[model samples]
Target: MTASSVPSSSASPARIPRRKPRAARIGLFGVGYHVYWGQFPGLLDELLAKLAVLERRVAATGATVVNFGMVD
Candidate 1:
């Protein structure tokens, strides 16, 4: 059989199936000693600053970061 004899269905332009949209929800939390804040002096601020940087980096990767910082 020649190429012309082939059925058109094999080469037909059927609508391509589309995939559904993907969604992801992520929660990011940090922990530290709340009681030590007074004794440590600036410990709370240090830990929070670090957590903020981490959250920013993670968010940059397209992930939704729910910051639950300073868990007492």
Candidate 2:
């Protein structure tokens, strides 16, 4: 059986520690550009707006905003 076919409670899973990148700044972006969601300009606008706020929020937490990744 494939992994997805296994019963949820039947197996012990390995937990990997999520090591955060040591870069001074990181920008997270959605997959809208590569998908049909980017067809509408409004979609990109909204994405940029949200990313801008997110960058500020992350920067407030001490991490720098290298780029919001919203290129239009």
| TM-score winner | 1
Query: For model 2, how does the per-residue alpha-carbon lDDT over 1-72 read when each residue is reduced to its tens digit?
Result: 899887899568996876975556676764465464556657766777888788788888777767638543
- Whole-model lDDT per candidate: 0.82, 0.70
TM-score of 1: 0.65
TM-score of each: 0.65, 0.46
Clashes of each: 0, 0
lDDT per residue for candidate 1 within 1-72, as digits (tens), equals 998988887586877676965455568777877789899998888888998999899888777889888886
Superposed model 2: Cα runs more than 4 Å off: 1-24, 34-41
- Span of ten consecutive residues with least summed lDDT in model 1: 16-25
